[model samples]
Target chain A: MRIVVPAGGTGGARFVRGLLAALAEAGEPADVTVVGNTGDDITLWGLRVCPDLDTVTYTLAGAIDEAKGWGRPDETFTVRDELAGYGVLPTWFGLGDRDLATHLTRTSLLASGATLSEATATIAARWGLPGLGVTLLPMSDSPVETHVLVQHPDDPAGAPPRLVHFQEYWVGLRAAPRALDVVAVGAEQARPAPGVLEAVAAADVVLLPPSNPVVSIGTVLAVPGVRAALEASAAPVVGVAPLVGGAVVRGMADRLLPALGVEVDAGAVALHYGASLLDGWLVDTSDVHAVAPVEQAGIACRAVPLLMTDVPATARIAAEALRLAEAVRA
Target chain B: MRIVVPAGGTGGARFVRGLLAALAEAGEPADVTVVGNTGDDITLWGLRVCPDLDTVTYTLAGAIDEAKGWGRPDETFTVRDELAGYGVLPTWFGLGDRDLATHLTRTSLLASGATLSEATATIAARWGLPGLGVTLLPMSDSPVETHVLVQHPDDPAGAPPRLVHFQEYWVGLRAAPRALDVVAVGAEQARPAPGVLEAVAAADVVLLPPSNPVVSIGTVLAVPGVRAALEASAAPVVGVAPLVGGAVVRGMADRLLPALGVEVDAGAVALHYGASLLDGWLVDTSDVHAVAPVEQAGIACRAVPLLMTDVPATARIAAEALRLAEAVRA
Candidate 1:
């Protein structure tokens, strides 16, 4: 099976790990292509940082810090602390010493005229991604960063909103302030990275893992030609709900989803994606009532245990999504 | 007193610490400006690493690793070890975690359009150099790296010599290979950084600390207008010999000096600078015989105990250099 997954950071990484386990257990031979979101990419201390791509790569390589759900195991913060000592700003983002090596390598490659896609391939290869039957590509080679518009803290009343990089909102501000809107700054001008469109078009199945719909999957779809390719793909497109029991399993989806006026409900999220793009949707058993509402919108829907507490439990969820794809094909 | 000193790493930094201490003890209020060599600068992992400038800054700030003669007081190699694990080349250069912070700050500043001089001032301020009555400036704002020509290890018999960055030769190869020649790649066209020439011309006394003459002090002089300024200055130009007992006190000067066809003797080095640029020279008492030859070359020469074994001993040597400068002025 040729599978393509559009991923974000921690949550998407976990979901993909489960999907890999599901395929391996069933004795299925597969080629998985991951189209990672570049909307959260930020240049820190003159180094290009691709948070989502690194998370996916580290998780797959079994080098990730399982407790934090991101970064390398046994990471040190000596560099971060030293940077703070130098009075460099935005010290809130945790850049581990081990994780910094990836940024350094990628940044060095980019400095030498390599495109983002090329640099990502080089870094992913270091983590042995190809050996695991996975190919990871950025959503686009051109820069596209997510910026969040939030009410200015100092001028809360009758003041124009201020724009902050998504990382500042997510990591620095902890997403506390109300988000007025989110914008993918360069997405409109960005073409899909080489092989990204073809991956979606040629896949036996396209999966939308449990990632932030607004900044993760939505940002990937925002790249020109990407949404068109997915819409035109012959394969079934299935999505696993990022929410369980009307609450996000991880990340600040609840804080950001409402910025687009989407309710904090599994059914609302599925409906927001709508039937034209999604052939099937999977919600948690606790939100089984969402199944009926989603299916009524011309999309196949299923409810299963979606906690992802462990690999086994998450693999079961992935298997159910694949089964729903088969049903949609029928 | 207004003083100017041209410096490199380790040895020069140690000499400067003693100068500062000597000035303090004598109740002499002096504005000491250090022109640091930039020929040793290299871009590793896409970050600018200024070994000489950092060494002087860290030593003056009392944050230097005393045991190693450079870098921070307490440093970690997490970043270095991790970079090696990623199979990055040139891992021989030691980039401590705390030291990497300085490079990151500098690289970020330079990327944002700050010149090397401006960046040095900003970094020096953080280390409290200004508070201690010291001003640090790069020899040039423009990039001028020293490349050593050495016989290629693999093709020792016939292939034309290959050029390696000075760091690769000194740190990576331990300067074991015979150096054919040294070139300051961009020095001929480079202009002195702001205040460098002025510091030389306006100084009450000019001191050349015991830095590597070939790559450090010599490279600074190679900058188009710098040598002219030092020669034209009214202040006496005095140098402390890097050699003691006919050998380098530290570093690979012994390996590199012969490449210029100059003998390892203190008198030979003073004559290499010639009487036009240097008004006085200080050699170790063990090489007291060098004084007669150096003086015969129309330069004032002194034989002092030049071993900078500790702050007090180094301070006495610095005091002797200052006394020689005064005598030359008379």
Candidate 2:
């Protein structure tokens, strides 16, 4: 089946990385299309750093840092130290030596007038992922920076006033401050990345992995015509809850949930995705009580253990989600 | 006393590194100015690779490898290995991880419209140099590549002569093949690097280290006005012989000398530099007999035990060369 996955952060990437492997093991070849979120993209030290896009590329290449779950594995930070020596002010995001090479190569290509999509394709080819039979793509050629509105501890007004870049919030601050809003700053300006709509429409199944709703899948949906394409497609669109219960399985989703005014629970997450576009929603047994509410809202909800302890478990969960999706379509 | 040193390449750099320490110990502060050869300049994989200029910078920065005597000490090659995996071919020259950062910074600066000389100054400011208040300038803003004409051994019918870049000949082939010529391809068009001629003309004494007389020092003289500046300078220009007895100290200088139709001996080398520009010449005790021939050519000749075994010894050598220049001028 043609699967269109709109992934944003590491969580989304980890799931797809397994899904591709699972499909291969099952003797079923999948025509997989990825619409990566560009919202977290920023011009870092002059190189365009698309964290989400790199996550996908690294994961597919088997070069992703399995422990930290971002950047290339076995990387060095000589360039970061050198840049610091040059009196470059920001030293928050540590760019490693090998990683700096990719950023440099990408920046050089972009400087030469190639679109981001084309550059991504060239980079993907370098990773030797062609044999995987998956088409990876960024959501837009235009820049889209994700900015979070957080309540500053120093602010006497108690207002969530400042907008911080995603990397600053996640990597620098470690999401310590209480955030009130997460905005895709250039969402209105960003068009769907090339072939995003076509890939979505052609897909037989659209899977929304356990990525952050606000920043991961949210950023992909924010692009013009992408969400519309998913809604218009005949494929069974299934979403697996990022929030396993009343808490995030990984990452600092709990801290961000309050900022977006979304409840820190799987049921709320399914409801947040809404029933209009979602044909099936997978929830853990802890959130089974919320299934009726989701089904009543037109999404067929299934209660199952959703913690992906291992690759096999994650693939099984995907299969169960697909079955639920088929039931909803029937 | 001011010294004009036209240098670059590992040998030149390593010598200067030792000379800097030696000069400090001898309580002599040289108003040193380095006219770095830019013949090895290349834009590899879109990166401005100034092998010679970087050698001088790193040497002055005290970060050069004493063992390899080329790149940064304790250098890592993660980028080069990663590039290799990505099918980036012709990875002959080993660019260390820390070293690549320097190249990238330089390339980025150049791409942003800064002249090579301006970029060099900014890099120098990052690393504070002591006992060396030297102005480092490239031989030209326009690239001047050195090409090696070698007889192709693999060709069946004595096919047309094949020419390869200097790096390919020196680093890749290790200069084993029979070379027809060593041409400074673009030196004719290359302007004297900014402030080179002024440094040469204004110096009180100029001393050449035991650097590659053909490639390293030859590329500098190839620049448009550098030779003329040396000819007109009131300063006594003296050169230390790279050839100890009949053999080259390091690298394939003996092989290269033949390409220029010069014998690989101290007397032949001094004869090559000739009388008009050279007022002083330093030869080893082994070649003490050739001092008369050099003096007969209208240049002051000195016989010195010229092995740079240690810092003190190297300093003694520098002091001897300068003393000879002062004596000749008097």
| Predicted model with the maximum TM-score | 1
- Residue pairs with backbone overlap in model 2: A76-A97
User: Residue A308 in model 1: shift from native, Å?
Assistant: 0.9
Task: After superposing candidate 1 on the true structure, give the runs of residues whose Cα lies further than 4 Å from its correct spot.
Answer: A154-157
Candidate 1 - chain A - TM: 0.98
Q: In model 1 chain B, where is the ten-residue run with the lowest total lDDT? A: B82-91
Query: Tens digits of per-residue lDDT for model 1 on A149-232?
Result: 998576769988999999999988889999999999999899999999989989999899989999999999999998888889
TM-score of each: 0.97, 0.88
lDDT of 1 by residue, B1-330 (tens): 889999999988999999999999999975899999999999888889999999999999999999999999878888878788667545788798889889999988898889999889989999999999999999999999999999867675888999999988888888989999999999988999999988888999999999999999999889999888999999999999999999987887888889999999899999999899999999999999999999999999999899999999999999999999999999
lDDT against the true structure, per candidate, is: 0.91, 0.81
User: B226-298 in candidate 2: lDDT tens per residue?
Assistant: 8888989999888888888778777788989998999988978988988877888889999888899989988
Among incorrect, acceptable, medium and high, the docking class of model 2 is acceptable
